[model samples]
Target chain A: MTKTELFNQIKTKKSYLCVGLDTDIKKIPKHLLSSEDPVFEFNKAIIDATSDLCVSYKPNIAFYEAMGPKGWQSLAKTLEYIPKDCFSIADAKRGDIGNTSSLYARAFFDKSASGMSFDSITVAPYMGKDSVSPFLEFENKWVILLALTSNEGGKDFQNLELAEGTEVYKKVLEVSKNWGDSERLMYVVGATRAEKLREIRAIVPDSFLLVPGVGAQGGSLFEVSKYGMNATCGLLVNSSRGIIYASSGEDFAEKAREEAQKIQTEMAEYLDQFLK
Target chain B: MTKTELFNQIKTKKSYLCVGLDTDIKKIPKHLLSSEDPVFEFNKAIIDATSDLCVSYKPNIAFYEAMGPKGWQSLAKTLEYIPKDCFSIADAKRGDIGNTSSLYARAFFDKSASGMSFDSITVAPYMGKDSVSPFLEFENKWVILLALTSNEGGKDFQNLELAEGTEVYKKVLEVSKNWGDSERLMYVVGATRAEKLREIRAIVPDSFLLVPGVGAQGGSLFEVSKYGMNATCGLLVNSSRGIIYASSGEDFAEKAREEAQKIQTEMAEYLDQFLK
Candidate 1:
């Protein structure tokens, strides 16, 4: 989807929420296990319940992949099930050399090739331009490059200070600015480091930030909003465990919607205060 | 395979050569297109011809994945076809958060999970220790972290100067040292930076190094062998296009063997000088 279309969705939904589908088959309701495709069934319920409450759905591909070919089948089915109006992200942190990356682009963007085309796929920038540019070839699809990640190990290299006083990920954004525009490129800035959003926003003010590490990771949605929101409300604050795994009972999907609605309500207030 | 088993394979074959299965459908022989699975057929032929000449087979996962589900099937078949003694490296540069990384580890290291089990996987360290440690959970499986890549874009972050006068990749090696030892871990130091191998070897002396960009990318085997060799002949120099795509006609696999044989012959001499 285009930037303008995404902005319109954010406004219409009154939220910049991107519900994470980190669905673990083992963690889902045991009753669902009797079904042929439990992961897909679970995701269908979650999407059905919370589609109106969020602007996007980010499926962490690893969860599906851990289950094998059947998992891939579920992932493809889930990708097909997502509403076209709601942006879909295959949070597959994939990147490699120029040729290999082009194939990865095909695997994610060319549905005809991989049987799944996401609106965007998260990428790692360690390999530089060749690793990232291939995903940009699919017009309108996005490449969400890993910048400042949420995990503890993110400090290992991402936070390295340079002689010029720039952290590694900031320099990553700076160097990568030459690769693609805000229209086709987004950045993954962890919500746990909400304070860094202000600095990250200064570098790429218009680009959307897929902020993971919210609720369960102890990041406040309000802090993520205050520092990260742009004129277009370009902050996709994600909540996976806090929402999807809220209740593993038969009402799991309903409980997920409740948590999503709670987040959406707060997001609406921030959208009004920040965008008004 | 363990380090001793890998070293034995090197001595048994008299080569640390890693044949890259970068099988491009368009580049394969036209007759193979008639087969049920062209990429797998091609890989089967390549493996049948050169299994003894090389110590390892590094299938660039993107090449297979670009073809979709059938691609994965071909990969599984090819993995099953490789001789039991030969090491298999999934050249899938995958890394994510701790939980996600474990799933990825299962996807590659556990055959029952992903229908393919590789001895090692090349990982990019941009996300840091958590993204890598999970992959090390699989006993005897390896995590070959990307340190200094050979692509022009490799200079972007891997070569960045830190406040402590250490290059980014060196810091990656330093910080990652605490995560896993030389036994379960290795580093990918591109063949183009032959001189840098000495410095890298100093940091992780006992660790293996997967070196790509040997022939097609203009990296010399002699220089790579000179600076990179350890007491265990610690190098798996990879040559993809130069080997697999050696010919496009019916004689493709035969020519692949010939090219591999030539490299193996040279590698034998290097082994004699370095290991003797």
Candidate 2:
């Protein structure tokens, strides 16, 4: 999905919230467990409840993967359930050698292989060009390169000033941006790093940012939206547990919708400020 | 598996090679296509032929993920097929928020979930302490953090010198190391950076290094072993395409065995030197 399309969705839905589908079997409502694929059932209900309110749905790969083959089936099925207009992300932080990475690109982007193609994917830039370039090979698909993350350890390296007097993550964003245009390359800047977001925005103002750590991670939505947003509403604030696992009982999906609505309502207001 | 067990396997097999299962459906032997799960069949054949020559197996998760539901089935089945003594790795480079990361840990390490558990997993430390800590929560399951990668873009940030007069990757190694002991943590130092291995080793002298880029990416085994080897033979040098796709014909398994054998011979020599 192109940045323009993502922006359009944000404008149309009046929301920039990306509801994370980090669904775990243990966390889902017990009543759904009896179903053939409880994970997918939970996902379908969550998507049905929250799709209209959110601009995107981000599914972390590990949750589905833990269930083994069944988890993958649920993921593919969940991908199908997601509204086409709503951006879908396979939050599988993949990075490897170039040849291997190219194949990974095919697995996620090419429907011929998995019949489940994500609009974007979270990529680890640690392996450098070969690891990241493979994901960028697909047209219209995005490579969300890891820059300044929301984790506390993010300060361990990303914040470190380099010999060139720039931070390591800054260089990552600078060099990685050259591999693909703003249309294809998005970055993952943790929502908690709101102040740092301004500095990051200074470097790649035009690019979209996949901002996680927003809701449950304690990153304020207003803080991130105020500092990081661009003209195109260039921010996807992801809330996984804060939304999906809001309730573990029969009303889980309903609770998820309510939580998502709360965030989306807040997002709509912020988006309006930019629209104005 | 502990480092001692892995080291003993290398000593017994006379090889330090970890054959990577970066299996691509398009690249597998044609004969295996007739099977219910071609990827699993291909992996099984390769493991069977080369099991005696190699000490561990690293399955790149993207290969299986690309195949979707069936791919995951193949991955789980393949994990089951690997010899019990051989160290297994789910090369699913996952890192996210603490809560989400905990689920990922459950997926890869919790045998109760999939009946398949890996000895280690590659993780992106960009997310910091919370992201990496979840993986460390599983006892005896090593977290292989990306350090100096072998890819072309690796120079973009990994090599940049940080504020503390340390390279970005060096800081990652230093700070991330604090989250876990050497026994629970390892760093990925690409074979292409053989010359710099000494410097990396200086910072992480006790931790095991998961070295890639050896065969196809032009990293020299001799140089990497010379400079990177530690008291525990702290290395798990991987060769994916070089071994798995050694031949795409019917004799693919035989050819894979030959390819792995060659690397094993060289690794045996390195082990001899290091053990001495």
Candidate 3:
């Protein structure tokens, strides 16, 4: 989806929430275990309950991959079930050398080839430009590059100061901007580091930022919108475990809807306060 | 497999050549397309031909992922088909946060959970210690972290000088050492940058290095061994297209064996000259 269309969806819904489908087989309600595809069934319920309250759905690929080939089948089914108006992200942290990365692009962006096509795929930047540029070859498909991750390991290398006085994450932002414009690119700036979002904005002012760590990771929604929001409300604040596993009983979907609604309500107020 | 076991295999085979199974559906011999599982059929032939010459096999995961679920099934079959003596490397450069990385560890290392258990899997160090540590949790499995890649873009961030005058890749080698010892850890020091191997060897003298960018990518095996070799002849130099696609006709398997034997012949000499 185009940035404008994504912005329009946020405007229409008065929110910029991207509910993460980090569904685990063992974590789903026990009652759903009888279903042929429990992961898909649980995701179907979550999507049905909370689709209107969110602008996108980011499925954590590792969860599905843990189930093996059968998990991939469930992931494909989940992708097909998502509403077309809502953006889909295959949160698969994939990257490699040039030719191999092209196949990865085909894997996530070419539905006919891999039986699933996402609007975007999360890419690791350790391999640099060629590793990330292949994903940009598909028109309108987004490449969300890892910038300052929310994890504790985020501090290990990303925070290291260069001889020129720039941190590695800053260097990633400065160099990668030349590879793709704001329309085709987005940076994943962790919500855990809301202060860094301001620094990130100075580098890529117009580009959207996918912010994880808002809920379960102890990142504040208000702080993220305060530092990260731009003219188009350019922030996809993701909440995975916070919303998906709100309950484990048969009313899990209803409980999930309530959690999403609460976040969306807070996001609407932030949009009014922060939107340029 | 353990480090001693791997070293023993190299000594017994008189080579450390790793034949990369980067099998693409479109790139494989078209005659095999009539089979029940063409990719598996092609990999089976390649494994049968080159198993004796090479001490290791590294399958580039992107090739299989592009074909989707069926491709994964073929990968499972290929993993099972590889002889126990040969070390298997899942060249899937995957890493995420701690919890997510654990799932990835299971996806490749826990065969019962994901139907594939490789001896080693390549991991990207962009997210730092936590992203890499989970893979080390698996017993006897390995994490080959990307240090200096062979691609043109490898110069992007890896070569940047740190504030303390150390290069980024060197810092990765230094800091990540604490996460896993030599027996469980390996570094991907690309063969194309053979000159840099001398410098890398300084930081990681004891760890085995998985060197790619040989053959098709124009890396010199002689230079790699001269600069990168350690006690136990610590190297698994990979050659993908040069061996596997030596012939596209019905004689593909026989031709592949010839290419592998030529590399093994050179590797044997390197072992005799460089083994400490």
TM-score winner? 3
Write candidate 3's Cα lDDT for B203-255 as tens digits: 88999999898999988998998888899788999999999999999999999
Ranking by DockQ: 3, 1, 2
TM-score of each: 0.98, 0.94, 0.99
Quality of model 3 by C-alpha lDDT: 0.93
lDDT of 1 by residue, A194-251 (tens): 5677788889999999998889988888888888888888889888999999998999
Q: A55-154 in candidate 3: lDDT tens per residue?
A: 9999999998888899899999999999998989989989999999999999999988999999999999989999999999998999999999999999
Provide the overall lDDT of each model, using Cα atoms, as 2-decimal numbers.
0.89, 0.83, 0.93
Tens-digit per-residue lDDT, B1-276, candidate 1: 999999999999999999999888878999999989888899999999999999999999887777766778888899999998998999989999999999989889888778888999999898888999899889899999998898888888888889989889889888887888877888888854556877888898888888888999889899889888898998898988898889988999999999999999999999988762
Better candidate by TM-score, 1 or 2: 1
Q: C-alpha displacement of A73 in model 3, angstroms?
A: 0.2
Ranking by lDDT: 3, 1, 2
Using lDDT as the measure, the top candidate is: 3
Two-way DockQ contest, 1 vs 2, winner: 1
Which digits, one per residue and each the tens of the lDDT, describe model 2 over residues A1-276? 677888888888899889988887877889998998888888999999999999889999878877877777888889988999999998888777687788678778889888788998888877788788878878889888888787776776667777777777888888888888889888998845566877898899988899888877788888888888888888888999999888888999899999998988888888877542
Model 3: CA > 4 A from native: A192-194, B191-194
TM-score of candidate 2 versus the correct structure, residues matched by position: 0.94
lDDT over C-alpha atoms for residue B234 of model 3: 84
